[model samples]
Target: MAKKAVCIMSGGMDSTLAAYMLRAQGYEIVAVHFNYDQRTQQKELESFRAITARLGTGQTYEIDLDFFAAIGASALTDRSIDVPTGGIEAGVPVTYVPFRNGIFLSIAAAIAEKEGASVIGIGVVEEDSSGYPDCREAYIEAMQRAVNLGTRDETQLTIAMPLVHLKKEQIVAEALAYDVPLELTWSCYSDEAAACGVCDSCRLRLKGFELAGIPDPIPYRVKNGVS
Candidate 1:
């Protein structure tokens, strides 16, 4: 039987590329997406479905956690905390969903155990990220240990973070090399209709494309001098 990998896809370029890489390594993919009442929930779900179709993977899961909205800590989940559009700041931004990756990995661990999968792939880019504590490699590694300790004795799982140390430019180059459908992915922290070019997410993405010498395919509300 072919080895299976449960990929935690967020419908962004990074996650999509990670899933594609896993598939390239000869693992049957089990794509998983979480909808935690984020600002761009609909857009993300649409992208996830399109990515799954492009991958031609039959097994997929879309889990909704409404508690995020109730908790209301992060800018993505709370309406009051405006998403920073000025630029990438010095510390953990308001957009950092509280303990989001940890929660997602925990659920992915359960899915991996149920599916008898050996690997769980998550797209976490720490080098160019917004300093979210949950995106740190050490935290993820600790989570992996805790997950294994909590799971059945026979079930062993490795949490794969392919983009942990890569910068956004490198990720863009890698995604292009893999022929990932970049146009289908969404990275805007605010505004679902068109990307707000000033947001941290958009800035990083545009910078990546610029550094890669590749024009971004998605439309942005403000160009902000990004070619």
Candidate 2:
């Protein structure tokens, strides 16, 4: 029997690459995406479906957690707060969705156990990311311990963080090497039709492509001030 992996994909470059990497390792993908009422929710959902179809993943989950809108303090979930366009900031960016990865991983653990999957893959980058606290390696490890302690005694799970230490450039390069459909992944925190190139997320993605010497396939509303 082939091994199974429940991959928590956000339809972003890093997460999408993580899923593809798992598939390369010969694990049957059980893709999972979350809809938490973010600004680019629709675009992300569309990308998720397309990416999974291309990957030919097994049973998929499109879980809705609308409570993030009500619990909104982040710019992605609350329109009141503007997503930063200047550059990546010093500490945790306003885009941090309040332990969002923690919540996502918890749900992923449930899916992994129920599906009889031994692995749970999450693409969380610490160094080249937008400085989200929940994306740190230490935090993910702690969450892994907690997830196992709370699950069934016989069910053992491995939380995989394939891109935790990689730079955005590395992620982009790896995705291309795996023939991942980069255009199908959405990274803009706002603006679904065309990426707002100056936003932190967009800038980081653009920077990655720039450093990788690859042109980003997605359309951007503007091309200036993307650093």
Report lDDT per candidate.
0.91, 0.91
The weakest ten consecutive residues by lDDT in model 1 span 218-227
Which portions of model 2 show Cα errors greater than 4 Å? none
Count of residue pairs whose backbone atoms collide, per candidate: 0, 0
Q: Clashing residue pairs, candidate 1?
A: none
> Candidate 1 residues 1-81, lDDT tens each?
879999999889999999999999998999999999999999999999999999977499999999999999899999999
State the lDDT at 5 in candidate 2: 96
Question: Over all chains combined, what TM-score does candidate 2 have?
Answer: 0.97
